[model samples]
Target: MSSTPPPLPPHALDRLRAAVRLREAGDAESARSELLALSGTYPRDPGLAYQTAWAHDVLGREAAAVPFYETALAGADALGAEDRHGVYLGLGSTYRVLGRYAEAVATLEAGLAAHPGDGALTVFLAMARHNTGAHHEAMSALLTLLADTSGDPGVRAFRKAIAFYAEDLDRVETGD
Candidate 1:
């Protein structure tokens, strides 16, 4: 029952769309640079901050992206429901990449609580749990995802990811 967020001004939307295109083209640095340049005009725009953080995340600058993600989230009310919920996944993933498993778990768990049906959040939570040696819980979540043989590509991808992690766990357990 979330209402749609108000539309961005034409100029802002155009810039954001161009930034997205840059990202899709695998030019994260360009996208980040563009977004940063647009920051002054759309200073408090959550979408701009999110794109900036997303670009940094894609460039593997977890430390650099963290603050921007936090900034975007701090002004989350400025975003639509979709963006508000999606930011957690990126932030949680950045935390995981930084080896901050506790923070990752906390961020992902909170997101999962808010969006109970988000498979992405569930998978991330499982990943964080696995990193923390909560192998059983991780396996439980993977198994649940694996049960969804619905032929949806996204579900298939999640299953494959779960399998990859499960294999790692098995190898570790077997000392191989």
Candidate 2:
């Protein structure tokens, strides 16, 4: 028996694409409706679950999105890398906005462990840390990300200094 999951039926794929298009066209409500309907028919589809969660998120329904995101992530082996990454970010960010800071930190940390050096994930992780009162870690993460990714010439010039300070923001240096 083939270990690979069977490909989605053509009609299902078309419906999924149409739902995504609705979302992109600024009709998130319609998208959510379509995705929810499709999810009823394709209850085990990881991709569908992910899209349903995204639609809920775009509609400012973070709590409603959590179970769908969890379902998608639980079936991670069936999802593409990009979808997996989105699940982690979406779930983590949703948790943060919902005041579930510890869950956000755990989710984002797990994502970073799996997809290291991702700027978006790092940024969200920093936000989660800040919410959890890990101010030092949050600032350090933001500073490091800024130093590594900022395009401003001035920032580039001071990258080394920023990195050094990121390691120890409260450091005091005295000339002897």
Candidate 3:
């Protein structure tokens, strides 16, 4: 037999980290149960609440995530600026994934006004615009973002994504 390893069952911390991983690699159902249990223990912990919301989000449980995220945001009112930004980002992402494009745009725009150099928010706004058929504006925003000096990985990805969108739009219009 080959020397390949079998996958291990996820523990609480692994489940927690995987829950927030970008590609949805976690035991979200287990994460929800653990977080719900922890919520009773740490009822006032914004960090725990935020993780719970993120777990719900990754599990495609948008309705379940919203109130938890809102609670985290409210609890973060006295925290650092970065923490507050994170809250809006989570809310904006949840709304976007739920097809609430208008709310995504509005929330992300408000976050952008507060944190002007946020490439992540810019990409998110572009995605909302693209989903809402505002492709031209999306392309413009991505192109504008490409010109920024302090280039982040997300900005680079945004540029590439926008280029792809532009090509797709061309194909649609030209019937190619």
Find the candidate with the highest TM-score and give its number.
Answer: 2
lDDT of 1 at 77: 75
User: Per-candidate RMSD vs. true structure?
Assistant: 7.2, 2.0, 12.7
- Per-residue lDDT of candidate 2, residues 2-39 (tens digit): 54446679999999999999999999999999999998
What C-alpha lDDT values do all the predictions have? Answer: 0.81, 0.93, 0.71
> Which sequence of candidate numbers ranks them by lDDT, best first?
2, 1, 3
Residue 162 accuracy (lDDT) in model 3 = 55
Worst 10 residues of 2 by lDDT: 1-10
Which pairs clash in the backbone of model 3?
Answer: none
Q: List, residue by residue over 8-112, the lDDT tens digit for candidate 3.
A: 235544644554553355567777887777666655556667778877877789878888787776676544687668777888888888899888888778878
Error of 3 at 109 (Å): 1.3
**In candidate 3, what residue range of length 10 has the lowest lDDT sum?**
1-10
Q: What's the TM-score of every candidate structure?
A: 0.74, 0.93, 0.61
Clashing pairs in 2: none
Candidate 3: where is the Cα deviation over 4 Å? 1-28, 40-45, 149-176
Distance from true location, Cα of 132 in model 2, Å: 0.6
Q: Please give the distance, in angstroms, between residue 96's alpha carbon in candidate 3 and its true position after superposition.
A: 1.2
